[model samples]
Target: MKKNEVPQDGDNLVKGESNWLNYAVDQNGEYVQEISVGWEPENIALEQAWEVVNEKVEEARTKVLGGQLSPIAFYMEVNIMDIPLLANYMDKYQWQVRRHLQPDIFKQLSEETLDKYAYVFKISRTELMNVPTNKNTK
Candidate 1:
């Protein structure tokens, strides 16, 4: 597909779980089973799997959002000056580079951590990408 082509709404996985636990009666007022409670993972791999699944899901979401805004999006190249030069550097540049920071902040803040300090703010997609740069580093 071309870059500027309009996208058809594909099948989107409506994200999130349903509240299957809370239950009562439907048409006939009957007692329903309470939400089943499950014990925590007994091993390491099971716990790690959950974390990995969540990470991939969030990454997919970011990709979709990035695609939708790509036409109007501008990406800025950032070189962190404070990062000490690594002795094992192999790339052409020695400084740390970054393109996105909002996602970084979001990832850093857990659901609980973010809830404590979270404040809503309005921002355009351009602002999220740092508004791009015209100057060449070279």
Candidate 2:
């Protein structure tokens, strides 16, 4: 696309407060960089993606609160991590992490085990032991 043809449909993402560096062909048929407010298609796609993320967070919250899964599961969703990633961070096997996500197993964990999980999740041991009542915050 030409430099002048760079999309400026609207700046929904940043509300006109930020600009993105974009490259396009100048009138001389040379590549040039320009600032763009935003592109509508990209903005819409991001909005949809965030909606899906929020849905996952909400589902995790529900499962944790209902005792169907441990707070580890909810924290995993919040951190955008999977069992393998959490296991890698905790220096444990995937089966161990998966087992930890079971509320029964989680409740029986030692302080040392819980502390490791808290450290990886960047939360206090208390916070790791309990799920927040609200999804966004306590």
Candidate 3:
């Protein structure tokens, strides 16, 4: 298919925004520069992605309410980060991050450690200490 032509229905590239290479010719028939024309297809992939995120958030919320997971775990799920990724972002070891996932351990964290986590999560220490009951509140 030509670069300038949009894909028909059921094409593989129909999921998200796509770039089309466009070209023009001068009066003397000299080839001019090309530009990428961007366009988005009509699709529900974005909605589906959001649904998955929401589902994860709900799962985390359940764990937090059940006392099986710490508030930190809920925030991590809300931010769509796993233990290793969050540990890397906070520059802490994986074991330390895992420990923090325990409510007892999280409550015992030093103010400095709490500050570091708050910085990474972009929230105040108070908010981190008090996990919201509803994900929508965040």
Among these predictions, the greatest TM-score belongs to: 2
Best by lDDT: 2
Candidate order (lDDT): 2, 3, 1
* lDDT tens per residue, model 2, 19-125: 78999999899999998888888888877887787788789889999999999998888887888999999999999999998999999999999999999989999
TM-score of each: 0.20, 0.85, 0.69
Q: CA shift at 52, candidate 2, in angstroms?
A: 2.3
- Candidate 3 matches the true fold with a TM-score of 0.69
**Which residue pairs come into collision in candidate 2?**
none
Compare candidates 1 and 3 on TM-score and give the better one.
Answer: 3
Off by over 4 Å in 1: 1-43, 68-138
lDDT of each: 0.31, 0.88, 0.76
lDDT of 3 by residue, 1-138 (tens): 233343333434344344444565655665555544333343356456777888988888898888988888888988889999999999999999999989889889999999988888899999888777766885
Native-to-model Cα distance after best TM-score fit, residue 55 in candidate 1, in Å: 0.7
lDDT of 3: 0.76
